[model samples]
Target chain A: EPEVTQTPSHQVTQMGQEVILRCVPISNHLYFYWYRQILGQKVEFLVSFYNNEISEKSEIFDDQFSVERPDGSNFTLKIRSTKLEDSAMYFCASSELLAGSGELFFGEGSRLTVL
Target chain B: GQQVMQIPQYQHVQEGEDFTTYCNSSTTLSNIQWYKQRPGGHPVFLIQLVKSGEVKKQKRLTFQFGEAKKNSSLHITATQTTDVGTYFCAGRVSSSNTGKLIFGQGTTLQVKP
Candidate 1:
């Protein structure tokens, strides 16, 4: 089965530095999403991207966060400035269809560590 | 705001025992989806419930959506060692089609042999 794939399985960055987490969603999928899970915390939605624009975002996805589909296959989440609290496992997910009820396939996740 | 809460943060049962996890949302959901993530792995899609009072089964696993579309349940019958994982229930709001899901805290199941 085709699955979402994320790059840099683990990332470590300095506190004020920028980090970009990359993901290649299923080739045919149209919608993409980014979610984060703090250690031992529930996974939290960050943003959703479709048609090359952000569909929705949560408070956690503030000024520092931005998502881009720079190419046909790559979906990336960029954080302008990392903080200690920004450390977590970031997951990229995609669905075969665009509906809210469609099944989402998630990547193994990129563990971001900020120090 | 969408809030999904799953009961029994942790469950430990002997092999062959039945295990169930409940998910409740503060608002009506357009759909409810279940996912399983083994320790050290990512969440994997299991099944989705779209209609109110809908029920679907996959082998030993069964899922049900509440009559009001605000709650759901996943039951695993005759659990085994392979059933050990964290089960998460995610909800999509009725009017949102952005594919953004609000996930519950999750229920971790430990099946002892």
Candidate 2:
């Protein structure tokens, strides 16, 4: 089956440094999303992107976070300055239809470690 | 903000025993989805429930949505050792147009052989 693919299976960055996580969603999917999970915690929604722009974002998605669809296939999330609390597993997901209408396919996730 | 809560943070049972996980939402949901994640793995979609009082079954697993659309459950019969994983319930609020899902803390199941 076609699946979402992410780069940098694991990234270790220092505090106050910029970090970028990249994802290539399924070929035909329209909606894309970014979610994060702290160790042993529930999955938390960060932002949703459609039509090359962010459709909705949660409070956790603050000024330091930004998402971009640089090309037809690449979706990227950038953090301006990483903090210790930003350490978590970030997952990239995509769906063929609207959020409530179809199931999401998630990538294996990129583990970010900030020190 | 929407919240999804799951009960019995952890469950341990014998291979032949049954297992069930319950999920409750703070707000009525337009739809609810279940996902399973093995240790150190990403969340994989299992099933989705849309209508109130809806029931769906897959082989040894049964899923139900409450009549009020605020609660749901997953039941597995004669669980096997392969059933060990964390099950999560995610809900989309009826009032929101975005596809943001509020996920529960999840129920971690450990089946002993």
Each candidate's iRMS in angstroms? 1.3, 0.7
Cα lDDT of model 1 overall?
0.93
| TM-score of each predicted structure versus truth | 0.97, 0.99
Summarize candidate 1's per-residue lDDT along B1-113 as a digit string, tens digits.
67999998999999999999999999999998999999989999899899889999999999999999999999999999999999999999887767779999999999999
lDDT of 2 at A13: 99
| Top model number, DockQ | 2
Chain B TM-score of candidate 1 stands at 0.98
Instruction: Compose the digit string of candidate 1's lDDT tens values, residues A1-115.
Output: 7989999999999999999999999999999999999986788999998899999999999999999999799999999999999999999999878635688899999999999
Specify the highest-lDDT model's number. 2
